[model samples]
Target: MINSVLMLLIASALSSSALAKSCPEVLDSTQRKLNAVEQVNLCDEFQGKVLLVVNTASQCGFTGQFEQLEQLHKKYQDQGFAVVGFPSNDFNQDRGSEEKTAKVCYLDFGVTFPMMARSSIKGAKANPVFTEIARQSGVVPRWNFYKYVIDREGNVVGTFASSTSPVSQDITSVIENNL
Candidate 1:
């Protein structure tokens, strides 16, 4: 009961979006396609907030996780956190082009948070941002929807498997304490 009350208090305390914050020191100067938006300034786009980066795929069974991700993003957004999606075609055949894939995600899921371009999240061609995520989290995503949680200070605090939901206790704890 005390834990639940504490959670409520923390959630209430963090009641504003950090999306507009000045870009932090961690994000790089990389421009990638955002859902329907043309090349957006990545770092400038999401400067001050805590971030949850997930490698997503359209055809995967784990695709249903989008709803949970959206929930987490929406619930914690006012608290300075975001769920950033990276649609990848790396495994078991990804459907649609990069833009089309992102479109499907937005239209189907009402994903309000940032969704970046499709990229290889594994092997030799993985994007530098992801490589950095992996290097810090100490876990290369084995498949799509693998989550890397970045704290407000830009530390890669944790990595979760594809099986882990965005609302998982571990993830929630990280956001509550680190964000």
Candidate 2:
């Protein structure tokens, strides 16, 4: 009877371990920050927070959106929301070097939110986080500044095109509703 009880306890412990390791597919990968050696795992860092994941290019016409994105990030961050930017050269507009990209994001825009290293955000070579996002949302970024809103549960709840303002009522409503 003691042996049976011991085996049951071990099984329960293993089950809990498995469950703990089950991060959502969309947030399971680690990404290096732009111009930094530090990396972060999306699931570990931003799980249970509403996220605005954007593909950015420093030279795009929509580059000015960084200010608005920063606004949204600041306003809602205390409410468990964050704007995560991924610098992508998929559309041929990103500043070529990481130093230039970092300057655009950090110096020019005063962006405080996480800005990931430059990576492909569309097509076959898209990063794992973006690939999973596209898979779940049924939308792929056609241009720089495309936005994906993910709920605290790590589900893609909304996809906004490049023309959509980060602080528009459409995006804000979803964020407010989720929070």
TM-score for each model = 0.80, 0.91
Could you say which candidate leads in TM-score? 2
For residues 1-179, write the lDDT of model 2, one tens digit per residue. 99999999999999998886678888989999999999898888998899999999999999999999999999999999999999999989995799999998999999999999999988889999899998998899999999999998789999999999999999999999999
Deviating ranges (above 4 Å) for candidate 1? 1-26, 35-37
The best candidate by lDDT is: 2
What are the per-model numbers of colliding residue pairs? 2, 0
Please give the CA lDDT of all the candidate structures. 0.79, 0.94
Cα RMSD to the true fold for all candidates: 11.0, 2.0
Model 2's alpha-carbon lDDT is: 0.94
The TM-score of predicted model 2 comes to 0.91
Residue pairs in candidate 2 whose N, alpha carbon or C atoms collide under 3 angstroms = none
Q: Per-residue CA lDDT of candidate 1, range 46-160, in tens?
A: 7667889898888889988999999999899988889888888888546777766766688887888888777788879987778778777678888888998888767788889
